[model samples]
Target: MPLTAAVLLRSAALSDQEFLDALYLSTRDDLQALAADPALRPMIAPMIAMQQKAQGLSYQASYPGAEYLVIEHAGAPVGRAVVHADADGLRLVDLSVLPQARGQGCAGSTLVQLQQRAAEGGCELHLTVRLANTGARRLYERLGFDVVSDDGLDARMRWRP
Candidate 1:
C-alpha cells in the first residue's frame, strides 16, 4: 500500500499543457461531482480550460522563481508539483496527482523526495493544505509535517529536517 511505484520529477515543458490540464481536472473532486449530472457535464470542459489558464497565470505571478515539475511513472506524467526554494525555506506551492494514480504511491513518493531535499538543504519544508482535504493533511502529518497555522479553510504546515 506504500510506494508501489517508482516516481520521477522533471521540469515541465509547454508541451505538457494538455496533459497538465487533464490532470488538473482529474484532481478536482468538486468539478467531477458536478459533471456527474448530464446537464452539467457539457460545461465541465470549458470551465476546466478557463480555470487551468487562470491557475497557470496565478502561479507564475505568485511564485516567479518556482520550479514547475511533472511527476512521472514509467516515462509518462501522472501529476505535477510547483516548488519554490529560497533563503527562507522550501515551499511546496502546489502538488496534484491524477485520480487514477492517487492510491499508487505517486504523491507519497514525491513528498518523500521533497523531504529529502529539504533535509539536505538544512531548511524547513512548508506547504498549505485545504482543511477539507483531510486525507492529504493526514498524509503530511504522517510524514512529520505539523500544522503551524490554520484559518477556516486551509492549514499551513511545516516540517523540519
Candidate 2:
C-alpha cells in the first residue's frame, strides 16, 4: 500500500471535461457485458459520452454538496471518486479508474486511506453498488463493508471503523 502515499485527491473542475469524459467511459464496463454484438462495441464510447454529459448535469442538480474528486497519480489524473460526507457518514457515490490503471492497487490503497479518515472522524462509510457489478461488490467486501440493504438492482453497503 506504499503507493497510496503517492495518490492525490483533488477538487474536480470544468476544465477537466475531456479527462473526466474519458474517465467516465472507463466506468461503463458493465455495458461491455450487456452488449449483444461484438461489432456494436464501437458504438459504446459515443453513447457513453452523451450519457456522461447528461449524468454530469443531473448529478450537479441532485447532489450539489457531494465532493467530486479526481484521483491523481504522479501528477496525472487516473481516476475519479465522488463522495459525500456528513454527520452520519461518508457515502461513496462513485469510484472509477481508467482501464489502463486497473489492477495497479491504486484504488484499493486510496480507499483504505479514505476509510481511515472516516474512522478518525468516528463516521461509518457507505455506498450503494449495482448488483450486476459483482467484481466491485467483492472488492468492497474485502475492504470490510457489508450489505445493509438491497433492492433487486442495487445493494447498499456500510463500513464501520
Candidate 3:
C-alpha cells in the first residue's frame, strides 16, 4: 500500500531528537539478540547511537543537500525519509516507519511519489537496503525497484520510470 493523501513530509528539526532516537531504536530491536552476551547487552544503547551518528555523517558527506524529512500521518510523526536529488538523479538515502505505522499505506505512497519525482527528472531512483530486511525489499520490488547488486549485508536497488 502506498501513502495516503493524509500523509505528508516535513523537514526534521533540531527539537525532534527524542523522536528520532525512539524511531532509531525501533528499527534496531533485533540487536537485542546480542543481549544473550551480558557484555554486549550493556553496549546496545551506545552502539546504536554511534551507528546512527555514523549513518548521519555518511549521509551528509554523500548528499549534503539531502532533505531529512519526517513522515507525518494526520499531523503525527510516523517515520523519517531522506532524499537527495543530484546530478545522478535521485537517491533515497533512507526511509523508516514506526512499527505502529507499518502496513498503513503511508510509506508506499511516499515511495511512489519519490519514484514519480525521479521519472519527472528523467532518471532513476537508487537506494540500498539491508538484506535482512526482506519486507522492505519486497516493498521496493512491488514499487518497481530492481536489485542492482547484493553483497550479504546490503542490496542496492534502482527504480526507473
Candidate whose TM-score is highest: 1
Candidate 3 matches the true fold with a TM-score of 0.83
1-161, model 1: which lDDT tens digit per residue? 66645799999998998999888888888999999999999999999989988987998888888999999987789999999997769999999988778878888889999999999999999999999999999999999999999999999999999
Q: Candidate 3, after superposition: displacement of residue 122 in Å?
A: 2.0
Q: What digit string (tens of lDDT, one per residue) describes model 2 on residues 1-161?
A: 34644878899998988999878766666765555578887887778877887887887776679899999887888999988877678988889988877777768866887899899989999888999989789889999999999999999999999
Query: Which one wins by TM-score: 1 or 3?
Result: 1
Cα miss at 113, model 2 (Å)?
Answer: 2.3
- Give stretches of model 1 more than 4 Å off: 37-42
TM-score of candidate 2 on Cα atoms, chains taken together: 0.81
Q: Rank order by lDDT, top first?
A: 1, 3, 2
Worst 10 residues of 1 by lDDT: 1-10
RMSD of 3: 2.8
Candidate 3, pairs of clashing residues = 2-105, 2-108, 2-109, 3-106, 3-109
The 10-residue segment with the lowest total lDDT in model 3: 1-10
Candidate 1 clashing pairs, residues 3+ apart or interchain: none
